[model samples]
Target chain A: MSDAETTIPRPSLGRLFWVFLVMGATSLGGGVVAYLRTGLVVRQRWLDDVTFVELLSISQTLPGLNATNMSILVGDRLRGGMGALVATLGMCLPGASLMIAAGFLYGAGGDGPWSKAFLHGIAAGAVGLILVVLVQLGAKTLKTFADYVFVVVTAVAVAFFKVPVPYALIAAGIVAIWWHRPRDKDVR
Target chain B: MKQLWDLAGVFAYLSLLTIGGGMAAFPEMKELTVDTYHWVTFPELLHFYSLGQLAPGPNMMMVASIGVTVAHIPGALVALVAFFLPTGLLTFFVGRLWTHLATWRWRPAIQTGLGSVAVGLVLAGAIIMGRGAITQVFFGVIALAVFLLLWRTKINPAYPIVASGLIGMALHYFNIA
Candidate 1:
């Protein structure tokens, strides 16, 4: 059958490997920042703003690995189930293999000068990249005054308040859900 | 194996909490697996956390690593399935519903509200990231400058990441923290 004919078959393992590799290679600093990088397909090519924004939204909202969500979105767009499977696996494998290797290498000794230096540059550079993500994403979503306030408040709450992660998440989630829940337009 | 099943249960639980993805869930995972369960020690968990960080596919990768460490291949399988299946089903269903519901005016309001929530979640994520990465003032400054540069530069993600690594090396050579 031609490639288009298949709707949701299991993806070929080899193709999945490449997809995994691409995601793996790009996510250098780790998961915290990699989504911004892997988002290039939407940012640089193929997808448009509204569509890309929507994809990102779905990816972020979903509970699975963000990278996997991204990959599945990309994969389903390209080929179908096989593609998604490939993408998810592709996105995941690098970290898995790398971790295993690192596990083997764990406690090998102290950090070498180069490793330390490399990590330092990464640590610094990652901040810049993450900052960029925050701004760009913010611009897309934060049009109103309320949004602006939310961002400011949340940043302070976490960075300074040092509220534990789960509580912060729950608290913010409650606020947003309640804030957005359908209200009587006339009442407002 | 019993170990695999246990990993599955943990991953399943963790997946439900990933409202904003891995970073959103990191602290929770760190607490449950690292502190509460003591399945992995803090420092050891940190290493796997690093692997989860640099791993290519998804931040949830720590599940597989965690599983593997806990119980070999089956452990990995349990963790993977536990983490993935529930979330995938839920997301796909939610996506369908979200699209169907997009016609509502209140959708925009809801989105706006969620946007705020995302900010809060990410803010929390950044704090977690910061506590780990920022050991001293020099590193802290680097993070700040880098955040600004990303906003202004429109540079490819790779460039910044690579530059950071190189920058890390430079700091080491110069004896800068």
Candidate 2:
């Protein structure tokens, strides 16, 4: 929709795959979005800022992981179905291979005391990382008092009551959507 | 063969539950993988998850780890395809249809509604993970320190997390924790 989409030379699907593969390998520390913006917008000029943000919004609203979804959407926009497949594969392959290796290593020696201590400590730290993510997401998403209520209800249903996630997701999602349903007096 | 199918089914199901992020499905992932399937223990799940955070791509690639643990290369391949394919298809279709729905009035409601709920899910996940992860004094301190550092600084997360592992090793070596 932006001028760049029209002006930028369309890259070949192989090129698309290679670019995304580079991104997948280098985007450390879980900030794939930032890396995406730099690669697609700043460097490749494949998409301008506005278009990049628009695609990112779609990625967030959808049910897939942000990184993979962004790759699919961007790749689809660039070169169609094959592009999407290549991009998503490129984005995922590096991490998937690393994790599989981690799995094999853990299986081999994960039960030793040293490994136990190391894993335990990393798990604790990962908890902190998750908390940071939660706060950032909450700050971005929770805008109203009622929204806060929905969050608490949903959290309680899952964490305390052990309600199944799908049930909680559906029930809370329906209620929250209806609560935010269009009001005649409301102006966007 | 049964293990492969189970791995596929479990991860495919878990994949859909990741609304806001993979962490949103953590409790359920734990419930099924650790408690139900007995594919991995709680600590092992936690370990895989922690290591996953260090991985460069999507945060939930740990599903591959679980697959490898449960079966092997076939399990790993099956898990990756299963975890990704369903949601990947959904995303592709919905993404194509996104612009056509922009003018619809309920779009904002759907976004806002799902937004808060997604946050809640992440909070619940953090709590569940914390319960298992922060069981000791040193571990708790590590969590708190990492939280504060991340909140205040722009440092890459991998450093603190790797440091946390090293600190644990050191503490164990010194018999301090």
Candidate 3:
């Protein structure tokens, strides 16, 4: 890793921000991960696939949006605290501005019947998108029958019983972790 | 004044619930913003969320929309900062420590365990969003078509999603929906 780091020229903070900003502005739809890969690995040659996947795993496990988390991690890796700051800012800026503008338009009576119909249709479509994401995530994460059980139990508790997320996350997380606890025999 | 504080506190708390992805936090987000604080109606929340999909960056940038609706620019800033800061710091520090924990015996267990739970959270969120989004058979057909198209192809999602909105407009034009 150190060898690879030494070989690739580290990007200045401005360039770092620019790279992430372009990705932020271009990653339409929801698959920001793919955009990050193309920008970092294919375009910039900043990180190889292995490192990208490693950072991505950490991003996934943490409690934040993957795009911003990746920005932070990759930024910190390249240029320390300042890099993380700039990268995250760049990644979020375009979207934040657009959504804020959307809020204003919405406040100014943008929700006419026609717009409402459009929003309703998009809302339904977004459900389909989220379902696709859910299916893909399940395929990658779930393996054993017990894993599927955890998924089902957690979903039911939250959706049907109206359990608060914190409580549900903790309860399910603890039990799931215990079930997968390290064993001596498995250490090999 | 109080609303700014409320927005900060709500978004900050909501940010931590986005374990696997932004969608994982959707249900709780709907609860606080709509049911609890009355920041937006349920349908409005759905609209902002759906619009967020077309936005360029993170999927949950709709938080800023909620913030804007509540208190304009300041509200948006506070919500954005609060939403990103705590978890951002956590990721920054934990990401550094992650390399050291690479050899930790329980690492794989934690990863595997959390992966399942994360999927569950996302599933829960999907169910809740579906309840609001799929109000009619026409909408259901749209959703199914989008799902199948995206699932089966490499085409960009923006095309189909945009088409869905246009289909919606057409339905409205004809008074079909």
Candidate 4:
């Protein structure tokens, strides 16, 4: 039989949910993408490397969290709409539950001096983390001098002028896309 | 009833702003959730965001905290569903059409353009958040140190963040902060 004809059957919806649940529960420190590649591409063979990358690019390009986007894309590819539903729920449930519990805990004790101090410290540390993420993303995505210029302009627009994020996003996005518009000389 | 509707509307709106990642939505999230609706304080928003970084799934699951703060478990469910659904449907339909558009000449342009802007938005978010997060000299030092460490080292981020929190507690005990 051809590789197409003898392909592994689609995983059951329950198994899809179970696998995503395990991934969602175990993917620590915000590296869900790596865990996802390992689980879906390497271990389970639900998708090949090329398809995984394609889905990932889609996830990144769209406006959503990568983990949930990946879950929706991958699950849909595997078992249609119901698969997408289950996968997204599985991915979100563990973390959402914890955060809800955290809300209750903070409501109760967040005003205590020690809790206040701790939360403040973590906030500062999270700033560092966000900065790191910004730098890494910049390194990967930015190419041209104009691209760097767009980044700075957009940042200043929001951070200094208080231009709303949606406005900045649209304004910068339009300019950047027009600048990079199909260059005939550099045609791929 | 109206509160839940408001929660749903706010998150759904914030959801679209998350182009690059959850951080891309931070500024608007702060504007609507903290400033507009008063569902949580700035410090509380920061706290939930920080806690979310340590959580196991999608980083933006912190929205659940805001929901719970507003209306308990049902609120949390509403927020999550609202935040995810609109973008989720977009991705589903777009992902299907993406393959046919692979050969479209403008695809690369759109990708590269959006990529840079997304980075900028995340930078903008960090700046806005920094105003609140980096209040004191010690806090600034902690942020700088964590930045350098994460930039240079392969260590997991949780260790340093948790350590920073413990140090904060100690500093407060000693009347430093």
Candidate 5:
């Protein structure tokens, strides 16, 4: 209900696990934000929008899929260790199982035209989905020209300059860390 | 055993960087699986990339192709599970922390940046992956269309993806691009 209690209102492990299971099968794009917003915020009303944004941010920083991180965060909120495990499994197992099957199919040559057709179709569609998600997120996240500029320059750097991703990441990370250093100090 | 462990290590590293989605890891993924390890050839990566793009879930699922290419069945299992684990755990912790300090120093900025970076990474990935398939005009158009249509339209958009493959196959059938 009201997550207003200061004593760290934990969600029920069982309920979160159930949600985790459902989300595993459905969540796509690796964004996991939509699933969290829909499942936890809108459908279940487990978290408000403010909470969702906060949780989403935390999920991004940690070293994993945003959805997986979300499962854990939600799980821990609800039921600590069990919640974490179930949530992880929920996000991990479905994709892993699918991958294993894909591995088998792929190993078997994936020879059929239908299979090839299916793959080609889906790949193109996925990019479309990616573009949609990108625009949607840009609306939500990048509010300024500078942010858009970063997006443009980053895309150009990778496309035109043939910048290796690791170097790009390292450069971005340094810029981010340094850029934020002043603001971080201000907040502290 | 060493190979399985190697698989584990690769997934772990990839998982860490893969922040927004599976595609985010592609550039690194291409470098590691194709360029560095030669687990698969570049053309093979394009095939896998194309498939991953088409599939419904995470494009990172393309990592499965690497597993299949490596030690077959077992390699796929190892990579899929291992790559996901660290991130799963990390997400759980971060997810919990979301209730507290998401608006705090650096968190908000980092997240905003990640959202943008994820998109950039996907585009970069497409460019890197498309170069391999771009020798022919038809393929080039398909690639460009895929990018443009994705950027421009919201009309469900699945149609182009399905149609493109038929175009490719028909091209092959007719001795075309």
Candidate 6:
């Protein structure tokens, strides 16, 4: 319901696809969100910062990859159903093709000691990358002492006790939601 | 054929568990793909995952790698569609409904509540992956170094990650690790 939504011109489906395709092909490393913000808000000028953040919040609240979810939401906003389709396809195509090719290559030459050593090192580096993501996510999402407790309980249950993720997600999710339930006094 | 079906079912199921991000589904993905299906060994899973990080788009696109391993191109196709389609549809419909739910009372609660749990899931994933990836002290140092560099700087992550690989190669040449 922002002015940008009404003011911005709707892009053609092809344009949408092309724009997202470029983002998919160039958003190197793991931080697709920053690249997305640059492409959509800064470069394309299709959405303002507020709208972008709002859509990003929705993307985060939902259960999908942020990059693809953002693509669908933004694409839907710009050009409706076909826009969503093309955007998701464009965003996924580059990585998908590369990974498929990687699969073939790995199958052919993966067992070599050199390849194994390199993969091992990168895997360790990836663990570092994931830790950074976790710390950043925790800072943004976690607030109260109880919230930290929820994080620990969930982590221990899953990683240590080997509790299935679904069970842990459901049990922790319900409790956390109820604890944060809107109180009548705090109506905003 | 059966392998294709298995790939579809497993990835489709796995997709729903990725609430916060792809990492949230890592442990379960490990369970099904490595322990149960034997499609790829643990080291191979870690390799694909790290390489996926280097890939340009979604980090979890490596799911296709597993599928390709199991059943070639067909497996990849099935895994991609299955992994994406259900969640894509859910997102499309829910995104439309989001505007209507803007003022709903429980909206804030749902957002905040899920946010914490999602963080926990990602943490769990990191721990599980660390167990597999940080086998040696040298690798541990690499992980910590990358963590500090990324935590403090604005540099592109790809650079440090590639350097880590090169360091590994160097170590191998010198028979250090």
Best by lDDT: 6
lDDT scores of the candidates, listed in order:
0.61, 0.91, 0.93, 0.91, 0.65, 0.94
Q: State how far residue A166 of model 6 sits from its true place (Å).
A: 0.6
- Which ten-residue region of model 1 chain B has the weakest summed lDDT? B46-55
Model 4 over residues B1-177: C-alpha lDDT tens digits?
999999999999999999989999998998899999999989889999999988889999899999989999899989998999999999988987888999999998999999999999999899989999888899999999999999999777888889889988988999999
* A1-188 per-residue lDDT for model 6 (tens digits): 57856787699999999999999999999899999999999999998999899999998988889999999999999988999999999999999999999999999999999998898889999999998999899899998998998899999999999999999999999999999999999875
**Stronger candidate by lDDT (2 vs 5):** 2
- Compute each candidate's TM-score over C-alphas: 0.72, 0.97, 0.98, 0.97, 0.79, 0.98
Q: After superposition, which runs of candidate 5 have C-alpha atoms over 4 Å from their true positions? A: A1-15, A27-32, A61-63, A111-129, A137-139, A143-145, A152-164, A180-188, B53-59, B95-103, B112-119, B133-135, B143-160
Q: Mind giving the per-residue lDDT tens digits that candidate 5 earns over A1-188?
A: 25545544566666666677777767644435666688887998777887677666665555565656667776766667787777666665666567666667765866676555445444444444555556665676576666666667667776778687667766765565444443624654
Better by lDDT, candidate 5 or 1: 5
As a whole number from 0 to 100, the lDDT of residue B35 in candidate 3 is 94
Better of 2 and 3 by TM-score: 3
DockQ values, each candidate: 0.44, 0.85, 0.89, 0.86, 0.42, 0.88
**Could you tell me how far off, in angstroms, the CA of residue B63 lies in candidate 2 after the best superposition?**
0.5
Ranking by DockQ: 3, 6, 4, 2, 1, 5
**Interface RMSD, prediction 1:** 3.8
lDDT of 2 at B168: 87
Candidate 2 per-residue C-alpha lDDT over A54-118 given as tens digits, one digit per residue, 9 for 90 to 100: 88888887787999999999998898889899999999999999999999999999999999889
Model 2 has an lDDT value of: 0.91
Query: Candidate 6: which stretches are off by over 4 Å?
Result: A1-5
Q: Per-residue lDDT of B27-112 in model 1, one digit per residue for the tens?
A: 66766787766777654554455445445546556677677667666666677778887886676556546677767766666666
Whichever of 4 and 6 has more DockQ, that candidate is 6
lDDT of 2 by residue, B1-177 (tens): 999999989989988988889888898999999999999998889999999999998888899999999888888899999999988999898989998998889999999999888888888999999999988888899999999999899898999999999998998999987
